[model samples]
Target chain A: MGFLFEQDNFALFRDGFLQTIELSALSALLALLLGTLLAAFRVSPVPVLRAFGTAWVTLFRNTPLTLLFFAVTFGLPPLGVHFSHLVFAVLALGGYTASFVCEVIRSGINTVPLGQAEAARSLGMTFGQTLTLVVLPQAARTVLAPMSSVFIALPRNSAIAGAFSVGELYSAQQTFSERGYSIFAIFFWVACAYLLISATVATFFRFLESRLAVVR
Target chain B: MSILNRPASAGVLYDAPGPKARARYRLFGVLSVLGILGLLWYVFAALDANGQFDPDLWDPFQYNFVQQMILDGLLATLKAFGLAAAFSLTLGALLAAGQLSDHKPVRWACTGIVQFFRAMPLLILIVALYYAFFAKQSMWALVIGLTLYNGAVQAEIIRSGVNAVPRGQGEAAYAIGMRKTQVMASILVPQAVRSMLPSMIGQLVVTLKDTSLGLIITYQELLFVGKKIASQPMNAAGFPYIPVVLVIGPIYIAMCLLLTALARWIEARGRRGANRRTSPAA
Candidate 1:
């Protein structure tokens, strides 16, 4: 503990923490959007589209995210399609996560009653209009909690960025340890960073939940 | 309103997709097409630029070094996974039972174990355990770390599965003079097992993937072998990095797919039995 104070690399720690936040934000946003779209495809009227979406989710959901990261980082470069490790990390994380998110969103959509869609159709709305007008709102309520937890998962997984030398919180701590910082102190700080981020997000989700309850 | 019969709202949350949704779909379709085309173009360009598509550079199965390392790594990985899977399921059940215990100490102790272990990243746990305990460490640390973390997750899954089996069923069992332990052993455990099977298998998939983290502590897992292979400079491609990844990717995918299929089979069988018991005879 005293070592942390004496070393006083709080500035470096803060910058590393900020990079983690940036990486999380970008990946999460990209994942949610891609996931929602894939969820739509999974529940599409067309059988082939649904099958394709299911296969995509099944493949990604089954394979490990680390393996996927390795694939993107190592597999692409030899084909003369080199990406910065950071870019590849983000794409891999976002892409793999979106597959799980798609499953969550599809379940959310399923939770919404069929009557809502029928009612929308009775209003002479197109299928897309009916879905927009009726189904997604209710599904959103049901999925909010799980979705928030998935967001929490995103940051925890951001630690994998360290493998590629992305200089996130975990990588920072790894560097500190290599530089003769006490291993315990470095790890303790890393854990604290992860906890802080996760707890903040969990609190925000709880707030969102209560607010949604009030609306209901 | 009932869950199924509620009227839809007009807000974005309530509303489904409309013309804008169709347009968005079309846009994504076009984009996907372009993306695939671009990938194909890149592949061709790489081949043309390199003026050769060399197979030997990347085929680890063809080389004695790569094959030996991967085979050894594969066995080590399986060893860790097998031990962890058994430990996790057993430990998970015990912890799950403790969490649901009437006694406060047991519940608190289990909760603390579960939360702390689950919250810490698996890599850190592996490293910590390797350093802090087990003289040789070997596969034992990796197994213990995986069990500690995944067992916690499995405990939660089992607890929830058991809790979901209605309060009335437990009450009914107790009223029939069945002891608490008996009720849990005979009724709750069986029912929860069925409901929890898929999730447990899903956790196992996670455990299998995590075996790769063994690379950090030099446990010689598949990823470790891949890394070793890539660090060498024996291939004609000059950049055998991509080939190593491509070679290894399928191996991981194959293992995971097998687990997934097994889960689906068990789940199907369980559903059939459940349905047979519940439905009226023909």
Candidate 2:
């Protein structure tokens, strides 16, 4: 415990903590954007796009995040695509997490009653109009809880990025253990840092859910 | 209309296409198909130019030792998954029982344990376990970490499943001469297991995948083996990372998909069985 407060050791843990948050935030944004697109594609009138969306979700959802990280870290460089390690971590985590997010959003969309869409169609709303104006807004409400779970899992999954040299909290653990510090104390703090992040994310989502709650 | 063939959720998003709409969709579809094909071709060309498509890169997989290594890795992964699955389910059941206990302290303690473990990132937990207790035993570290985290998740699943049973079921059992344990064993658990099975299997898939984290601790699971293979530079072009991914990736996908399919099959059968049981009584 005393070693935790040592100047150099504290900096190492702090930097690792910040890097974890940075990776999670960036990847969450990417997952949301890509996932929304996939969800829309899955529900759209275009057969090809729907097929593509389904394939993307299935392929990604079944694959382990670690393997995806390996592919991005090792496989991509050979194909002439290059990026920073952080960027690679983001791509892998975001891409994998997006599959889950897509399912959450699509299921959310499904939970919106069919009558709502039919009414919009009766008003001669186009597909885009019905989806954006009528369907998606309603879906957003039901989607929040599951969507939160998905997002909460994102930071936890980003811990894998540490193994790939993204210098996150897990990497902090690696560093500390190698330096011969007390493993239990170091782990306790690292676990606390993770729990804090998860709790904060959980709280934010609960707030959002409350704000978005419909009285119906 | 063709909308009748699609799921209500998908179909309701748009009306059946009229002639103009149909024409527009056809053109958009064609363009999107062309775009996807173009992207695929670009990727293929890039990989080909980089000599990733060379047959030599795949040579290591053909060797007897390499194949045996993969087989051993697969067995090791399954062995860990088997132990973790058993332990997690047992732990989940105990924790769920404790959470649902009559004593307030017991319930609170169980809830705290579940929440604490659930909130921890599993990799961190595994690594911590590796260093703290199982420094020389990576498999136990992986298994115990998986069990703790997944058991917490499974506890929630089981608790919710039990609660989801209509309150009348338990009341009626108690209204008879049934003891608490008897009521739970005969009435609540059997019913809850039906609903909980799918999610339990789903978690098992997750446990299977998380086994790959063993690679970090130098546990020789399938992914670890694959990584080891990929790191060995057999050809001048590069390490066979792509080849290893192609080989090992499908094994994982196939295993998960098979489990998912099995769950669906069992669920369908359960529904049919329930229908048969009620239909005759009706």
Best by TM-score: 2
lDDT of 1 at A167: 73
Model 2 C-alpha lDDT per residue in residues A65-180, reported as the tens digit of each score: 99999999999999989999999999999999999999999999988888999999999999899989999999999999999889889999999999998998999999999999
Residue A103: error of model 2 in Å? Answer: 0.6
Q: What lDDT tens digits, residue by residue, belong to model 1 across residues B3-52?
A: 22222332222234469775665676666657656876987788656633
Model 2 alpha-carbon miss at residue B257, Å? 0.2
CAPRI quality of model 2: medium
TM of chain B, each: 0.82, 0.94
C-alpha RMSD (angstroms) for model 2: 2.3
Per-residue lDDT tens digits for candidate 2, residues B1-282, read 242135556888898999999999889889989999999899889989999889889899889999999999999999999999999999999999999999999999999999999989999999999999998999999999999999999999999999998898999999998998999899999999988899889998998899989988889999999999988987575699999999999999988898888888877777884443343352
Q: Look at candidate 2 and tell me the lDDT of residue B267.
A: 79
After TM-score superposition, the amount by which residue A169's alpha carbon in candidate 1 deviates from its true location, in angstroms, is: 2.0
The Cα local distance difference test for each model comes to 0.77, 0.91
